[model samples]
Target: MSRGVGLLLVVWLLACSGVHAQALPTQVSGSVSEAKTRLPIPGATVQVVRTKRGVVTSTTGDFSIEAMPTDTILFRALGYKSQRMPMGGIGLSQLVVRIQLVRDSVRLGEVQVISDRPDRAIINRALRNIKRPAPPVVSGAKRPPKPKPLFAVDSTAPKKPVPTIASPVSLLYDQFSREGKQRRKMEEIEAEQRAEKLRKARAEYNKAFLDNRGYTP
Candidate 1:
């Protein structure tokens, strides 16, 4: 009976080793692409289902991950439907997988963009109202001659051509009118003042000369 128990224990150990060998992780490498176009999908997520093991595809849509035969591999990417494949058939050997993802066809709502454009009418009106600047004056340019006044007087007068004869009425008015008498009186008074000033000036000069000569009057 003890021999039989030893054989059963040995059989149980062999079964456990076989199971552990089958559960060993395998290096899985793959490329993901679009279903319709067959174009490579970079940055695609390659994750082992029911575990945290995952990897992201490279620019060439290539990925490498360690996964057990019992685990399921999930491929996900933006704008594409998710895909899953069981790793059981691949076994412990290194395998390269090519997965094609279908495009998600859920249409998005239309977007409206409003641009801030000034009104064309206002712009045209502003352009029309803009006053053009006057032409620039050039230096050292000859200027046009200025126009003369309507009633300009000439300073150069002609020689005597015709002498007007005064009438008796005009001659008597100049000699006896109140204005004429006042004017004659003013002229006489101006002449007397001039004579008095000249006499005083001549007397001062004679006195200065006699003093210089030591003469007494």
Candidate 2:
């Protein structure tokens, strides 16, 4: 009975160990960086070669994904070269990888673009063949002479007699008009002289006031 119990116990222990090994996940965690600078490369794609499972690196260029130990992980970025690394015999719990990607360069071929427009020689030839119209000619006929008068005519008429202020009333009216004009002219001249004098006096006062206050301007 003791021997049978020992055999059953050994079988049960083996079965539990197999179950634990099968439950282990095939996963990996890693970081991607630039090969030259060792700087983290974010937004890099980490995909399994034979499966649809993939993950993108975080801001720190760290990524984790589920993949078999024998499967390949591809890292791709916009300007960097693509890299493939096989997860060969890597432990599931302690798989820490640091992938460095090299830079990719693509050189384009030189292309010469030819225009479909006509050459300058062809344009000059077409212009030379064009015909231009001649200018119009003027008439040679002479103009007729101006007509002359038939009879002699008077160039001037007789002068009329000039009238003078012979009456007393007329003479008085003329004298009064002359005196009124003279009075108005004298008043205007006096008024202008008074204004000029006042302006000069005010300007002199302002200048003296400014000078007393020590103002140069």
Candidate 3:
């Protein structure tokens, strides 16, 4: 029984050793610095751009990561240019590289402006020229001028003035007075003429009646 237990312990130890031999290496440790300043830079994202593997640098600019395949050690930060290290001749399993970041260039933005207005030639000239009508000749008769409007009025009806409140009563009164005076004069003349004719007609009737009655007219 004791010999069996000792053999079991040896088998367990040998199995553990084999497992350790097959286990993968955890990571590669590294640091990053600025190319110009030669100062350590923290927070640079160290990536293997080709394999999509990466990690951010620590506050002390140190990083620990698994190495990826060739031409793929890509380093980047917010305001810095990216850097790539070729791993063609180097074994990534032995990778412990220092990265150098350069400051990125800033480009100024561009703008374009446009405005709208009529060109000078277009506003000054007619689209097409045409002959104008000849002016009428003056005559000795002193032609009655086109009568100036009774009132300078609306665009549609220049001869008719829209009388305002201040002048309306006076305009109305003048109109009514002229009508009444003309009517009164016409009636007076008509009445006088009618009275004379009535008198003449009565004399003629009376003379005819007297002559028929055998009396002198």
* Better-scoring candidate (lDDT), 2 or 3: 2
Per-residue lDDT tens digits for candidate 2, residues 99-168, read 9998888776999999999999999999999888887666896668876542224344333223375676
lDDT of 2 at 76: 94
What's the TM-score of every candidate structure? Answer: 0.48, 0.43, 0.36
lDDT of 2: 0.77
Query: Per-residue lDDT tens digits of candidate 1, residues 95-185?
Result: 7889999999879899999878878998999999999999999999998988754333434432322323656676677677898778777
* Prediction 1 TM-score vs. true: 0.48
Pairs that collide in candidate 3 are: none
lDDT of 3 by residue, 1-217 (tens): 6999999999999999866644433356779988899888888887766668789998889998765333457788878888877555443355576777889997868877665877778756654454577997877757678856332332432133456788978667645778756755776787688667656655665675645332121
Clashes found in each candidate (C-alpha, N, C closer than 3 A): 0, 0, 0
Top lDDT model: 1
Q: For every candidate structure, what is the RMSD over all alpha carbons to the true structure, in angstroms?
A: 20.9, 19.3, 23.6
By summed lDDT, which 10 consecutive residues of candidate 3 come out lowest? Answer: 149-158
Candidate achieving higher lDDT, 1 or 2: 1
Q: Highest TM-score: which candidate?
A: 1
Over the full model, what C-alpha lDDT does candidate 1 score relative to the true structure?
0.81
